[model samples]
Target: MPIHYSIEIADAAAHLFAIELTIDTPDPKGQILELPVWIPGSYLIREFARNIVQIAAFSKQKTIPIEKLSKSSWRIAPTTGPLTIRYEVYAFDLSVRGAYLDQTRAFFNGTSVFLAAKGFETLPCSVQIKADSFSAMSKQWQVATGLCAAAVNDNGFGHYTAQNYDELIDCPVEISDFSKIEFEACGVPHQMVISGRHHADMERLAHDLRLICEYQIRLFGEPAPFNRYVFMTMAVGDGYGGLEHRNSTALICKRTDLPEIGSEQQSDGYRQFLGLCSHEYFHSWNVKRIKPAAYAPYDLQQENYSRLLWAFEGITSYYDDLSLLRCGLITFEQYLHLLAQTATAVERGYGRKRQSLEESSFDTWVKYYRQDENTPNEVVSYYTKGALVALCLDLHIRAETQNQKSLDDVMRALWNQFGRHFDTLGQGIKEHEWETIAQAVTGLDLTAFFDMALRSTTDLPLSNLLEKIGVQSQLRLASNPTDKGGWQDNPVPSACTWGVRTADDPQGVKLTHVLRHGAACAAGLAAGDVVIAINGLKASASQFASLASNAKSGQCYQVHAFRRDELMQFELVARDAIADTWGFCKSKDSCQVNKEMLATFLRN
Candidate 1:
């Protein structure tokens, strides 16, 4: 018999969800049920069980003893008949990874509420949502999710079914007075369910998303894996994140980042939103189905380590914005602008020289998720550097094979071998298997390239590879902190820099990061120091930049800062900013072969 669940918004105003789980054939001995401590896609142990405000078990309407075995597990004494586990979850986390509820809306991931009956996780399951629990707003509220509807009402209140616990939790549920826009890609129905407030141009969004979806679909070839897909989003004043699922993804973004109605020009924020959408959608094939061996059977209780996240996340990152250019949503110049910014971001970080991509992937739990002020100096992002690695690999394959086979071929081969039959075969790519697959697909041995990119901290040969495709590249000094790399004609550098980032503080200018070997580091200034004065002149966040800019080349400035209630004084000498920003442009010395290759690389 199928395990069943029914969840109701117990108190919308208090952000409570009351759920009941029924097991028809629970183990005769003590049965243990567990709530996953973490959710997949996002590499963080969130300890979802802490949100359980209250819980109890019963058999035949009589309260039964339930022993708390661990933080997230419970053992119910032997029950004669069917067992029922009831719990109330406090769901106020507003991000896509957790649960949230208010009078305005309610959202939840299965990991936050559903309990998996040990040894029976592979059994079929069903869930019923009590959408009418909120009498005042029940009429307008509707449900949106990827779960197969078993007996849902017109407003999407009722029952949903899943083949197993994994399938059930992989799909998140969103209920609110949301605006939905429907579109189709490759004959598969797709919908975007948006919560919160926004004046988004639905038609334009549908048009652009359709193009992106079609391109990605065609990339992996005909029969798409999912029958339908959903983009469930919550818009706020300022937010940005997304977590992928099999047939849908939950997203949060600033309302202003959405395309405005009747606006013809694309804003940078809107482009970023579109890029985020592309990134998660691409995961439907890459990370969602294309499994890393460590993730194939995810141990939701603890950390799952892999040395190949660079391949999954990095390759997806490389393709996210590139899809915008290939789909005609952005121009070639705009694409180059985005690429240069990514390269510059990696170049500016001192940690890239200290941490290898493999180490970064392995330590994602401790380093990537729990970042502090010294993050830039101690850690390298697998997303950015990994994308650069993917870029190098792509160019290398193209160059060696004379454009006969590309990274596209390698992805297709992975899909056919590992991802396509994943549901049935339950297999994943081994740690070193990607190299083997790439070699087989392109008929090129890339062991040296992989070793250098993953195991060593050596910078990628990006400029050289980009030049072969007729794109001239150069590194330049940034004029300001907000200056991300792009083509600039005779860009002027800042007069001087402290090599530190700062934010406005009520008391003074708060230092955020002190780059290694910078003036701040030399002067013994650390992150979290609040600078009160510079050369005896009162320093504020606004005035700090101008004061640093006006410093003489050889003059030292007296700096007064507060380091945790202790006033410290130091002498600082400003120096020229580093040339770490990258700029790119079409090469004037392009030959016919180079032009052909460039055309193929950026093919629409």
Candidate 2:
């Protein structure tokens, strides 16, 4: 028996969605229903059921007794006939993971709205959307999703079919008067949809995405998996996020992240946005189809733990920016700058010394999502470090095989073995099998490598691996590597560094964050302290920033700051600026080896 859901944009002013669920065959011993605690891709357990403002059940115009079994579950008292469950869900989360509804637009992930009939998950499901109220405002409003439309109108109003509950939830829907365009990648049609205001270069986006998508398709072989793909985005004031699906992805970015119709320069924000796209799109092959064993059949009710998120998300992270370089969306120098920034991030964060990628992947629920000022001091990001690990492995594999093989070969091997055959096998490689599989593919023994990279917190052997690739890495001084300006200036010796990150405040300079183990942290300056003076003279954050930029190494100065209405004074030594920036250059001797290896690494 099929479960059909009818949804309406009811009460858009109040941000409410009314949904009616019909179950044809209910369990004789009471039917169980539950909303997932979290969505895949996003590790946090966002209590989606909390958004249910009201619920009721009915049968033949009579009220049916519904018992609340848990926070997100309910049981319908044994009913011999068909049942109808009607509920209202409040949708206001602005990110890509949940749901949102306003006069301007309506977006929702099915996990936040659809309730699963526990025992009937394997049955087909149908979704019917009624958005009359939304259309009354503007006829241009349309729905965009990767879901299969069974019976629908030109504007995307109608019934959509899914093989099962999982397929239904995997396709998030966006309804708005959005700017949408279509293009083809490797013979597969694709759609790009965006909400919010902007004069985006639609053709430019299509051209770049065409290159990215086509390259990925050819990377694993011809004939892409999905017949169609969709990119649902919401451009906002200043936001960024992405959640991947089987055939589509939901993204959120700042308005400025989109390239202006005539602008030629690609801002860092724009590049980051593109990286988010590549990251999520890559998952179409890595996570969505490749199937992590633990995620093969996700237990949506609880956490499905896996150690290979480093492989899933981490490798994707590594390739996200690398894809840009490979596809010619950005230059090689820019790629190195991005890589250096990631290195600086992992190195500066004191947590890498304390946490391993395996631990970071597992503790995401407790630590990564819920972060504080101490996060940098205590937690290492699996996404960032995992990318580093992937790069290290790529370099190692290339060197061991004498530039004949690279990480690209390893990924294709995995895709062919696991992702390509997911439908037949319904499961994936076990946690303990990756090393053996990698050995078989690359013919290299990676025992010591995996141990240090995943099992222990030892720093990666970056210099040695790059040397084999015919590139050199060196720590240098000057403007911050992540400052978005290309490495155009020479390193100067007089550059001064501070241990504190400051922001301007009405009262004075506010220490928004103080890096641990730096001069500021050692001198007792903490986050949230307002610095009113330097050497007893008034200074704003900007003023102090200028003074510190030209500061000489190893100097002492009096600091005056206030901690919650208590003024204090402390003497601190000016340490040399942290030499964390790494500059990558082609070894003058092996320009040919560098060219060959780099070409092999970038090729599909």
Candidate 3:
């Protein structure tokens, strides 16, 4: 029998959702019900079942014996036949990974709200949504989701069907008086639904979004894959995140990031929001459809590791911004600045010296998601470095083939090889398959490049690789430093550049971090130390920041701070900034062919 489910806001004030699971046929031994311990997209295993409360099983108004087998699984003794399980979930977690509810709105992911029947997982399931009856505000709420329509109406409220339980949860439902606008890309209908009480410029959003969507579709040589797609965004006071699904994505952004009415100028916040949108949208192809070997069949009971996140997340990240540039959402200068910013961020981090991209991908469950104070000192980011790997590969292919083939060709080849055939094969790309395909597509043997990038913690040769893309580079300080011994003996007591980050508290300026080799560490100032004064002067948060950049070079200062309420002082010398300069310009000697290749890359 079909596995059927229904979800409703039982109590909006308490943020509780009532869920009912019905199975028309029960296993002769017993009926097993389990909620997922985690969701895809986010690597961390968040115990989603812990939120379920007050569960009961009934076969025909007769109580069936219930037994808890594990953290996420339950079993029911055999009864008359069709078994029904009713439960209430306390859905207050506001992030995109789980369920959330309030008088203002309601949102829930399938893993957070649906209970899967063990034997019927592969069978079709249906979700029936009920209107909120918990509060006056919920009365006016509407619904938006990506689930295929079985009995749902135009307002997106009612029954939705999925091919299986996996597909059921892949589409999250949002209910509120959100602003939803429909647009078409490559003859496919797409919806952008924003949930919040805000004045967003939907016209501009749909216009720019169409361009990005069309560019991506054209890039992979597919008119469209899904019947319909959705962008379910929650605009909040301050937040940023997204989780991708098969046909939709759930996103959260600061309310100010949305386009305001009558504003033609795109703010940095709006650009960042657009980038977020593009990032998640690109996942529809990269991570969602093009399955990684480790993630081809996710084991939601525990952590799943893979060394191809760089290929999945990194490549998508590389293309997200590039797609924007290709679509003319931003200028060529803006794209260069974005590239430089990414390079600067990756190079300055000391962790890149300790970990390789493959290691970073494998250890994400332990290191990337769960970070410590020493994270910057030990861990490298697969996303940033991986994007560089993609960038390097792009230039290598272009330079090798003399601009005849680019990374765009590599992606299309991958799509044809893995993505388009993912459903039937269910086998993701293997680790070695990357080089094999790159060689087959670009005719370039990249053994040395891939070895240096994935196997060792060596810095990417950006200066060398960028030359292929017609961009010249130089190593210089991101910021200049004052010459030593250039200050007077009593140099008006100015501040100088120091490498300490601080925040404000009632007592004084609290040290947030002391860079590994910075003056603060040299002076023994710990992370929690509050600086009450520096050199017998008041050290307020603002005052300390002013002095940090303006202070004299090589000057020793009598710094006084509270180390856990104990007064202490140290003689700290001024140091320069610990940041890297990432500026790229067109190579002076770049031939016309190389220049045209660069133009084709950025302007395509």
Candidate 4:
């Protein structure tokens, strides 16, 4: 008597697709069919269900007319017993979270699929997907889901059963010759399936991932809640993101981003890949388990608002690289470098001047996902500021308790208190609940910390906190090499200094801005100027970087630029670069304190 549904898809064209659904129910009387308005991980994404077209209903293998029940709901006429519902979804967009259908292949997120039973949210359900027969695919084309039982077939169909709607939504299926690597961590089976051309050291990747898993488990003082863990990496031609689930994570990254074993040790591409891994891994604890109260019982129809996204995403960001350090995947110096980079990015963002972390977290739907030119001016990223806020809070806790407790203690306490009880309640901890837990763990009132750091634009006391850990963060005016009108800090020969903020723009080598007092600025230039030629040779940003990679400081050159609809010429004098002049620091004292704090933080 369990609810069951099956889908049959027809690959009609390269950019067109069709799917039919058959559903079985005990009583179809007064039954209502509904499509989820939005999917988790992606907030404010509405109209996803509207892509479903040409919907038809059938009963006993006979065609029946379906009645429009509501905006996102439909009803079958004279629903007396079981019925079969069929629909066509337009899958033209090749996005990870949306349905994509083309001559090449097709992909789908369960939110695009509608469930005919409205009140049966808690009921058990099963799904069967009919694949394309032309492709010589096997059952090895794995199906990933939190669903209890799944069955595969040779006729291009995969069958899966879920305990409820939540379970169904968490499973994402990809059909391809995915590169899968399996290992064990903390006595649990771990699998990483990467689709696309992965050109990395597989053995090293698996080994490092295992260490990360083991470290996370030990930090929690218990094994992961799930018996199996899967990392579904979708390496498309050009994609960049990931979404976390209970037992799996859906990642969309560029195929070229998978670094080879001996690629540049400090390449941006490699750093980004590491950051992505850390981000998703941290989510296993933060977003998947220690969730926001609003997300506990998710309402797929609308935005689930919470003022604690800083804790969810920002705190997760703080821990991502720290987890890397804990697992020995990155050294303490490397970890500091990453933090310094994040600090520089946050400081450069003008949006931080306008938006508070709490406001940014609440308005994630309207701001973060839908970024535009004004975004840099109006919205601050909760991820950036939230991480800083977490850093500040961790330092505050450590300082107050004489390095006896830190943010790790707060996370463990949350896990012990709410994470252990989430299964029974089916929701996440409330915002206020965090305050109570913080107090319980730190024995200190966090009202000021939350109000100023999280809810307001109070500048973080990063210097004092970092000093306790033996690091120093200071900001000083330096030469701006990219700027046309700024002073350039010239260094002696044999030393190197390159200062320029370059990005790919339709216009040639677009110089976004010249650093104040930088070589380019001191030579006479301004922001919005495009560098057409360097040293009498036409070049782009990439080409210029390649040429300058070997150039030494105190180098002189003739630079040509287009400024304000006019061609201009200037002489440039290169300067010594101060790379770490933008953010707060941690001195030797602070480093020692932090090391001690880390020990205590991880101990209990």
Top candidate when judged by TM-score against the true structure: 1
Q: What TM-score number comes out for model 1? A: 0.98
State the lDDT at 331 in candidate 4. 63
TM-score of 2: 0.95
lDDT of 1 by residue, 1-604 (tens): 4599999988888899999999987888988999999999889889999999899999999998999999999999998888999999999999999999999999999999999999889889999987568435568999999999989888899899999999999999999999999999999999999999999998998999999999999999978899999999999999999999999999999999999998999999999999999999999999888989999888898999998889999999999998999999998889889999999999989999999999999999999888988989989999999888988898888889898888989999999999999999889899999889999999988999988999999999998998878999988877666789998988765567888989999888999999998888998999999999987888888788876667665568989999999999999888877789999999998988789788999982
lDDT comparison, 1 vs 4, better candidate = 1
List where candidate 2 sits over 4 angstroms from the true fold: 478-489, 552-554
If the candidates were sorted by their TM-score against the true structure, best first, what order would they fall in? Answer: 1, 2, 3, 4
Model 3 scores a TM of 0.93
Kindly give the stretch of ten consecutive residues in candidate 2 with the minimal lDDT sum: 480-489
Tell me the tens digit of each residue's lDDT in model 4 across 132-194: 442433444544444455666642356677777777777766555567788999899887877
Worst 10 residues of 4 by lDDT: 483-492
Instruction: Pick the winner on TM-score between candidates 1 and 4.
Output: 1
lDDT of 2 by residue, 324-425 (tens): 988889987788788877877787778998898988887888899888778888889989899989999999988788877778888888888888878667
Give the number of the best model, judged by lDDT: 1
What clash pairs does model 1 have? none
Q: Every model's Cα RMSD, please?
A: 1.1, 2.0, 4.2, 6.0
lDDT of 3 by residue, 427-518 (tens): 78776787788788888888898899888988888888777667766444533322211112222223345566667888788877665777
